[model samples]
Target: MLLVPLVYLVIALAQVQAGAYAAQSTAIDAARQAARQPEGAAARAQALGELHFADHGLESARWTVELSCSGDCARAGSRVTAAVEARVPVPGVPQIWGGAHVPGITVRAEHTDVVSPEES
Candidate 1:
């Protein structure tokens, strides 16, 4: 009845919230890790390693991270930015219903950190 749909809505909302929080944390952690690295390649590698979603109930979510630099990433005082995007599928939704596609919530987050002088 009405209660079933309401429960599904609540579950979808909770999943979206969890995905958003995870994306934010991932962006922050990736930016910090990249800022600590000494080169662009190393920074990207470190940042990719920090993108963890399983613990946040986003294990089945599609997610990706993009990194950018203000200038030379290895240079002191430069800024490293990490952007994370996650597509979380809505729960209790049929993959195909009346030609309707699976609904998903897109969560995004960005964080920036200055490259440490000591790392340069």
Candidate 2:
């Protein structure tokens, strides 16, 4: 009887956890793809696009991406890193309450890849 509400809450929390996992997976994939790209702007745009495609409910505006390259990024053998941070939305929960807004869980991921030395 009393446990029913608790069960529902647990289910809701699990859904939120699933969303967080999805966001994290998307971030990781996006970072890895961006790190493998040669152009900066194109890479960022493509990564964002991919993220949005994979997670439609997740807002692109809430995500931040950082790209770092060791040495010349365009040069072969250079290492590139892409870091992504995103706020995972809780299902059925609004961000605002009582004139104040609550924040969602933050998930972050990073990937590093080396340019092919022989490719360019």
Candidate 3:
């Protein structure tokens, strides 16, 4: 009886932890990639693509990346910021229920990197 709930609790915690790690790493990698790119649109696309490469058990479709720049993205010394957000579903939850009805935890991370002077 109690054991079942405990097992579920552990599974849920593990999922949350993995999702958090994925969000953080994705944010860092995406920011770095964006900082290296000269175009905002290209940078955003690259950052979004990074989600598919994340090792954690994240569903890329459930994630979003938002970007902001200190100035012209291509300018040396400018900083590019990437914010990643994801909704991780609880294990054993059926998705047939709409997302609004499904239980999930929201995880987010943000990272910033400066544009390299040589890239300008």
Q: Which has the greatest TM-score?
A: 3
Between candidates 2 and 3, the one scoring higher on TM-score is 3
Q: Provide the TM-score for each candidate, comma-separated.
A: 0.81, 0.63, 0.82
Which one wins by TM-score: 1 or 3?
A: 3
lDDT of 3 by residue, 1-120 (tens): 899999999998998888888778778877888888756644564555455435675553267778789998989899988888878878888878786767788988899899988823
Candidate 1 residues 44-117, lDDT tens each?
53345345676676777777888889999888899988888888888766777532356788989999999978
Which ranges of candidate 1 are over 4 A from the true structure?
Answer: 38-51, 96-101
User: Each candidate: what lDDT?
Assistant: 0.78, 0.59, 0.76
TM-score of 3: 0.82
Off by over 4 Å in 3: 40-54
Per-model root-mean-square deviation over C-alphas? 3.5, 3.8, 2.7
Could you give candidate 2's per-residue lDDT for residues 1-120 as a string of tens digits?
999788878875775565556545655555455445666644664566456535654542255666677888767778777666666555556645731344556766666777665544
Please tell me which model should have the higher lDDT, number 1 or number 3. Answer: 1
